[model samples]
Target chain A: MASLYLIGIGPGSMDNLTGLAVKKLNESSVIIGYKYYINLIRPILKNKEIIESEITNEVDRAERAVLEVLNGKTVSLVSSGDSGIYGMAGLALEIISKKNIDIDVHVIPGISALNSAAALLGSPIMNDFCSISLSTNLTPWNIIEKRIMNAAEADFVIIFYNPKSMRRQNGIVNAMEIIKRYRNESTPVGIVKNAYRDGQEVILTDIKSMDYNTIDMFSTVIIGNSQTYLYKDFMITPRGYSKKYEY
Target chain B: MASLYLIGIGPGSMDNLTGLAVKKLNESSVIIGYKYYINLIRPILKNKEIIESEITNEVDRAERAVLEVLNGKTVSLVSSGDSGIYGMAGLALEIISKKNIDIDVHVIPGISALNSAAALLGSPIMNDFCSISLSTNLTPWNIIEKRIMNAAEADFVIIFYNPKSMRRQNGIVNAMEIIKRYRNESTPVGIVKNAYRDGQEVILTDIKSMDYNTIDMFSTVIIGNSQTYLYKDFMITPRGYSKKYEY
Candidate 1:
C-alpha cells in the first residue's frame, strides 16, 4: 500500500509532535520537508532517507513527494506546524489531483503555530478568531488589508502569520493602522517568535505599544478583541466566560 | 514543585496526544476534565486520581484544578482539543489571576478541533480562515452573526464549532444564510463529526446541499472560501499557490 503522509511536526519541537505523527514517521522509509523543518525533527530521522528543500520551493517539494508515492513508496512530507494550514498538504493534494495520481494521502494534523503561540501567550485566542498571513508574495496586500479591517470590525481575536519579512516591512504597520480603526489602542497584543523552539520569545504588549520592528516572518502576532485584557503578564481573550459566570 | 498543567488531549484520541501532554499527565497526581473528555483517555488513567465534572460547570472545574495546585499537588486539567481555543485554559488563567495565586501554569498545546476537522476534510482551511462557535451558551447570536457575516465578506475559509446543540438548532441555518450572501451557493462545505474518535463521520457537501438537521454540538463544519474546490472527495482551498507556480 503506497501512500503519502503529510505530517505536521509541530512548531519545530519534537515534544509537540503527536504520537500518530511519530508512528507515521517511523513507518515511512523516506521523509521530505523544508531544510529547517527537517532539522527540527532530526532526532526521529534515524536510518530514514531525507529530502530537504529550500524555502519558496513548495511546489517542487510537493511534486516530488507525490511522485515518490506514485513510485510505490511510503513517503512522508513534514511541515513545521499543522500540515493542513499554510503547509505542504494543500500543494501536494493539488498536484496529485492535477496529475491524476492514484495514491493514498493521509494528513496527520499537529499543533499549529497558531496553537503553540496561543498557549505560550496564555490563551489569547479563546474566542472567535481569524488568522491572516501578511506575506504579499502570493496574496495581494489589498485583500490582506480588507481582512484586517473586517476582522477588527467583527471584534474577533486576530492572529497574523508572516507579519513581517526583510523585504516587506510595511505590511504589519499598514495592517495595524487598519485594525486600530476598529479596536482600541489599549487592546492587548501577544507576540511569539519561534514558539516551542530554541530562542522562543514571548512578548505581551498592547496595540499602541507593540514594536513592529521586533516582528519578522517567524513571529506570530495575536491582537486581542475589545474585551481582551492583560493580567499579571498574561494576555487573555475571555471567551465571554466572565459575562455569564463568576469564577 | 506544585503546578497546574492545562493540557489539550487532541480531540479524544491517545494517538493524537503529544508526547509532552502525556508526560505532563504522568507527572501530575490528579487529572481533571469533563466526564466525556476524561473517558477518552481512560486507558492511561490507571493508578491516577481523576476528577470528572459535568458539562456547563467550567468555573467549578477550573477552580478545583487551581485549588489542587495551590494545595501543593501537581494537577493536570485536560480538554478535548487545544486548551487555548475555547477550552479550559482561559478560565483557569482567569481564576488564577483574580485570586492572585502564585502558581506555575503550563499550557500544553494540542491538535484543536479546527485542525483535526480540517485534516479530515482535506485541507479545506489552507487559506485564510476564521473559527466561530455557534453555541449561544455564552456568546450572543447577534455577535456570532456579525462574525459570520464579516468572515464571509472577507472571503475567509470559515470553521463553525458547536454548530448545533439539542437545545439550539437554528444558529446553523441563520449562519449559512448570512454566509451565502457573500459566497456562492455551490461553495464547498465539509462537515466532520467526532473527528479522530470512534464512529467518526465525514461529509463533503456544498452550501446549498448541506443538511442542517444532521449537524449537532459534536460536529465541526467548514465552509470554504471562493477559491476552494473539491477534488475526488477532498475539499481544498488553494493558498494562492497556483497563481504563482506550476506543478
Candidate 2:
C-alpha cells in the first residue's frame, strides 16, 4: 500500500524535530511543501525528490502529494506546525476524499508555534486557552472578529496566529480592540516572532501599548486573560493554585 | 549556575522525543517526575537518579527538583505533555519565584496530547480551538464550566484534558451539558485514549450519543464546533479553503 505522511516540522528548527519526524522524512522518497518550508528542511533532503509550490497553491500542493502517492511514491507532505492544525493534513485528506484515492495517510504530530511561544514567554497558557488566526485570506474578517470577541468575553487566554501580514495591517489592531472590550487594557500580551527559529524575538507588553509594528506574518501574539500577570520579566497565568491549593 | 530542565516528553512515548529533548535528558544527572510519568521515561534514565513522587504532590516534586538543582545537580523535571501547558512548568516556576531561587530553568517543549489526538481523529482542530482541563483539583468547577460555555458559544473546537476520573465522574458529563446549550447534540466529538502510547484508542462519535463509559483520566476528548463534520471514518474542520479558493 502506498503511504502519504503529513509531517509537522516544528517551528523551522532542527532542534525541534522529533526523532520520528526525522526517521520518516529520511524514509520518504519525495517531499512536497511550500518553497519556504521546503528550504527550511533542505539540509535533510539530501537525496529525496523535492516538490516546491507557492503558498497560495495549497489545494494544488495537496493534490500533487496525493497524486504522487497514487503513483507509488512514498510522499511526505510537510507543514511548519502540527499538520492537523491549520496545516496540510486537512487539505490532503479532503483532496483524497474528493478524488476517491485510496492511500494510507498518517499525521505525525509536532510541537506547534503555540507550544514554542508559550515556553519562551513562561506559562501564560496554564489554563483554558483558545487559538485564533487573524489572517482574512480564507476566513472573512467579520467571522474572525466574532471569534476574537467571544473568546475575549469567555476569558480565554487567546493565541493569535498569522496575526499580521504585509497587506493586512489593521487585522490584529481591530482584533485587539474587540478583546479590549472584554479584557482590561492592562492585560498582559506576549508577542513572539519566529519562535525557535532564527531572528527570534519575544516581548511581554500590555494589550493597550502593544506595538503593532513589531508583529508580522511570522509572529504569534498571545493576549492574556483577566487573571494573567507579569512576574518579573515572564508572563504567568496562575493555574488557580493560589486559589485552590494553600501553598 | 545550577540548571533545572522542565521537559515535556510528548504522549509518554520514546518515539515522540525530540533530538534536543533526548540530549538534555542524557545530560541531566537526576530525573524527577510523577510516578506514572517517571515510569514512562524509565527506559532512558539508565544512570540518572530517579525521584518519583505521587501525582498529588506536584508542588513537592517541583520543590525537590529545585532543591536538587540547588545542590549542584543538573535536574530534569519531566511532564507528559507540553510542560508549559497545565504541566509542571508553572508549578516549578512558582516554587522558584516564591523561594527567590536563582537557578537556570530551561523549558523544552514537546508534542502535546491535544496535537496527537487531533492527528489521530483527522483535522478537527484545523481552525480556532480551546483546551480546558476538567479536573477541579486546582481550579474551581465554576471556572471550568464558564470556560466550556464560552468556548462552545464562540464555536471554537474544545479539547478536554483530564476529562474524567473515578471520583470526578460527572465532570465531562457536566461539560457536555454546557456545550449542548450552544452546539447541537449531533456535533462531532472525538475521544482518544493513551494517544500515541501503548493501548491507544480513537473513537469518533456525536455529542448526543457519546459513550461516557469509554472515557477516563487518560483520555483526551475533543468536541468539534459548528463547522466541523465527519467524512467516512475521519473527523474534519475545514480551514475555509473550499469556501475561499477554487482548486
Candidate 3:
C-alpha cells in the first residue's frame, strides 16, 4: 500500500520485537530512525534503505520518512520503545496532517521501556501508574515538576524516563524531593539501565537510598506507590487483590 | 530448571507476541490463562497441557501455574496484555513470595492494551500519561475517583481500563464528570475495543460527545491532555516538539 509504518522495535533485544513489528519491517522498503535505534535492529534491516540520523534530528527524520511514503515507497520509521509513546509517531503524523498529505499510516505498538523495566523488576507497576519523562529538552521543568507532584499526591506508581543526561543531572534529584513530600522515604524504587539490552543492570533501592550515579539517559526509574515493597530481590506492588481475594 | 514464565500474549493477537514469548511458550510443558486468552493463542498451544479458568479466577490460575512449576513442569502463565500492568505477574510473584517458594520466575513483557489502543487511536498518548482502572471489584471507588481527579488535575493523558461491565456502568460517566472539572468539554477522547483483535473498533470523539454504549470491559478509552487535538480520523498529542523546533 506504500504506507508509512511507524514501528516500535521494543527495547534493545531483537527477541522482544513483536511478530507484527517484524512483518512490517520486512514489508518496508526503507527504514528511518535515530542512529542508535537503527543500530539496535540492524540485524533484521537487510536490503533496505536505512536512513539514520542524529538523536536531535527527530523532525528531519520524521519529515524524510513521510516524504518517502509520498514518493510511493513503503517506509518504516522506527522508535526504540512504543512509537506512540514519547516517540516519532506523533511527529510524523503531525507533519503529514499539517502538510495535508493523504497517505496510509500504520502505528505498530511495541513493548515499551515501562513494560520491559517493570517485568525485569518483578511487578512494581502493578496498579495505577503514571510515566513522566524528566527530559526538559522539549517540556518545561515546571510542567514536569507539577506532574511529579500531582502523580505523587495521587499515590500513583510513578516511572521516570530520561532521568539523567550528561548536561541535565538534577532532574531526578529535584523530582524525588517533590515526591518525598507526598510519599515516605522508604518507598521502593526500581532502576533498570539499558533494559533488555547489553550491559543491562537492575537495582532495587528505596527513595532515601537510590544512587543517582547509577542512572543515566538510558535508564528507566520506577518509584513505587505506598503499597509497593521490596521482597528479596524483586520489587512488588499488589494490584489490590489482597483486599478482595485470599491470595 | 522448571521455571514459571509469566508471559503477556499482547492483546489477543498472535502477531503481537514477542519472539521471547513464543520461545518461552514453546519451551513450556504447560500453559495457564483465562479461557478467552487461552483461546486467543490456541494455535501455539499444541502438545502442551492447557489450563483455562474463568475470568474471575486470576489467583487460582496464578497459583495453579506456580504449583505446576513447583512440581517440576515448565509452565507458561499467560495474560492477554502486559502481565505486570493489571495482569497476573504481580499476583503470581506475591504468592511465591508469601509462600517462600524457591523457584525461577521469568516475567516477559508484551504490547499491553494501553499500547495497542494508543497505536490504533493514533498517538493520543505521546506526552505524560496515566492509566486508571475503573473497576471497583478490587479497588475502592473513592480511590479510583481520587486517581481520576488527580490525573485530570495534573493534565496527564488518561487511559481508562475496565471502563464498563454488565453490573457496573456509571464508572466512565462519573470519571468524565470529574475530568470535565479540570479539562474543556471538547477534549479529544479515543476509544478502542478489542484492540488489534477481531471485532476491533476505534472511535475518535470528544469529552462532551463520547458514546458510552460502545464501551465495555474489552474497551480502552483515552482522554487527551490540553495539548491533544483531533485531525482527520486520528487523535494526536504533540510531544511539545513545536515549542522547541519548527515543523
Candidate 4:
C-alpha cells in the first residue's frame, strides 16, 4: 500500500538520522518539505523528486502530500526535529481527515531540538519539563505568556522554541521576566543555536545574565528548574539521585 | 582523548538507533548498561566487551564506566531513551566530577519514548506540553502531584513516564484524579505500550474511560489538554493553525 511518511530529519544532519527514517526516505518516490529543510537534507535526497514550498504554506504542502499519496505515489513529507512536535505531521493529518482521504500516514519520530540541546547543556531535562514555542505567529502572546508563567510556577525545566524572530523582538525578554517571578535570578539558562548543525553555539548563563541579543529563530533556550546547578562547564539537574541514594 | 559516551538507543530497537549512536557504539571498546538494556542491544555487541548490572545499581554501573574511561578505554554507557532525560548521563558525570576523573564526556541524544509515543498516537504533543514521571521512588509524592496539577490547570498536554509498576499501584489513578479537577472528563488520553517494539499497543480513549490495567513500566501515557480531540482513531491537538490560518 502506498503511504505518506512524515519523517523528521533530526537537526538537519545525516548523522542524527535514524536508520528507520533513512530507509523510509529512500523508499519514498517523492519528497516534500519547506525550502530550508529541503536544502538541509539535499545530500541524501539523491534522485527523489523534491517539492519545495514556503514555510507559511504548511497547509498547502500538507494537502499536496496527501494528494500525491492518493495518486498512488509513496510520499515523504520532511520536517526538522520530531515531525509530531510542532512539525508537519499535525497539519498533514488534519488535511487528510478533513478531505476524507484514504491513506496511511506514518509519523516517524526523530531527535528534536530539545533532545540535542539537553545533551549539550548537560541534563537540564533530567526531571519534569515543559516546552512552549515563543513564536506568537500562530499562538497568541497572552496564551504563551500564561503557559510560561504556569510552567515557571511549577518549577519545570522550561524550554522555549523559536525564541526570537525578526519581527518578534521582545518575546524572550518578556518570557524571562515572567519566569523570574517564580524562579531565582541565578537560575541556569542554556542557549543552543543551530544545534547539531554548522555554526552551532552553546552558551551557559544565569536568568539574570542571559543575553537575548544573540538568540534568534534558530536557537532553543532552556531555563533550568530550582534544583539545576553548574558543575565545571556542565549545567545539570540531578535526577533525585543525590536525595535517594548516597554517592 | 579517552572519553565516556552516554548514548540513548531509542525504543531499544536497532531501527530507531541514529547513525551517530550506532557509530559510537561500534567505536567503543567496552559497552555497559542495565541488564535488560544490554540484552536489547545484543545484536550489535558482537565484538565489544559487555558489562551488565541490575537496574537498582545505576551508581555502580556509572562508576564502572567512568573507571574504564579513566583507564584509557573508550566506553559507551547505554540508556533506553534520551540519556540526558532520566538516563545515566547525569549519574556518570556526577561520579566523574566527585572522583576528580579527567575524561571527556559526550552525550548522544536519541528519540525519547515521549517522542515515539506521540508519533504513534498522532500529534497530541504538537502544542505546548510537559512530561512528568509518575514514579515517586526519588521524588516525593506531594511534589509529583503538584506538578501534575499545575500542568493540568495550565492545559499543557501531559506525558507520564513510568506510569505504573508492580509495587506502586495507585500512582496513575491518583494522577488522573488530580488532572480531572482541571480538565474535562472527556479529554483525550493516549496510552502507548512498548512503542515501536514487539507487542506495541496504541489506545485512544477519554480521561473518564482510561484503563490503567493495561499500562506498565514500558508504557507512556499522554493525557491531552482541553483542546485535544480524537478524529478517526487519531488523537490530535491543534497547533493553533485552524485559528491562525483558514484551512
Interface RMSD of each: 0.8, 1.3, 0.8, 1.0
Residue A42 of model 3 has an lDDT of 95
lDDT score of residue B129 within candidate 4? 95
Taking all chains together, each candidate's TM-score versus the true structure is 0.99, 0.97, 0.99, 0.98
lDDT of 4 at A53: 96
The CAPRI category of model 3 is: high
Span of 10 residues, lowest total lDDT, candidate 3 chain A: A238-247
Better of 1 and 2 by lDDT: 1
TM-score of chain B of 1: 0.98
Ranked by TM-score from best down, the candidates are 3, 1, 4, 2
Question: Candidates ranked by lDDT, best first?
Answer: 3, 1, 4, 2
Residue-by-residue lDDT tens digits, candidate 3, B1-247 = 9999999999988899999999999999999999999999999889999999999898899999998998999999999899999999999999988888899998999899899999999999899999999988889999999999889988999999999998899999999999999999999999999998899999999999998898998999999999999988899999888787787
Which window of 10 residues has the lowest lDDT sum in candidate 3 chain B? B238-247
Against the native complex, each candidate's DockQ, computed on alpha carbons, is: 0.86, 0.76, 0.88, 0.82
TM-score, model 2, chain B versus true chain B: 0.97
Order the candidates by DockQ, highest first — what do you get? 3, 1, 4, 2
Q: Is the docking of candidate 4 incorrect, acceptable, medium or high quality?
A: high
Give the range where candidate 2 chain B is weakest over 10 consecutive residues by summed lDDT: B93-102
lDDT of 1 by residue, A3-105 (tens): 8999999998788999999999999988998999999999888999899999878988898888888788899999889999889899888887777777898
Q: What is the lDDT of residue B182 in candidate 2?
A: 94
Identify the leading candidate in terms of DockQ. 3
Tens digit of per-residue lDDT, candidate 2, span A106-184:
8888889898899889888888899999988888887788888878887889999998888999998898888878988
Residue-wise C-alpha lDDT for candidate 1, range B1-247, written one tens digit per residue: 8989999999898899999999999999999999999999999887888999998789999999998988999999999999999999999988888778889888999899999999998899888999999999989888999999999999999999999888988989989989988999999999999999987999999999999877878999999999999999699888888788877
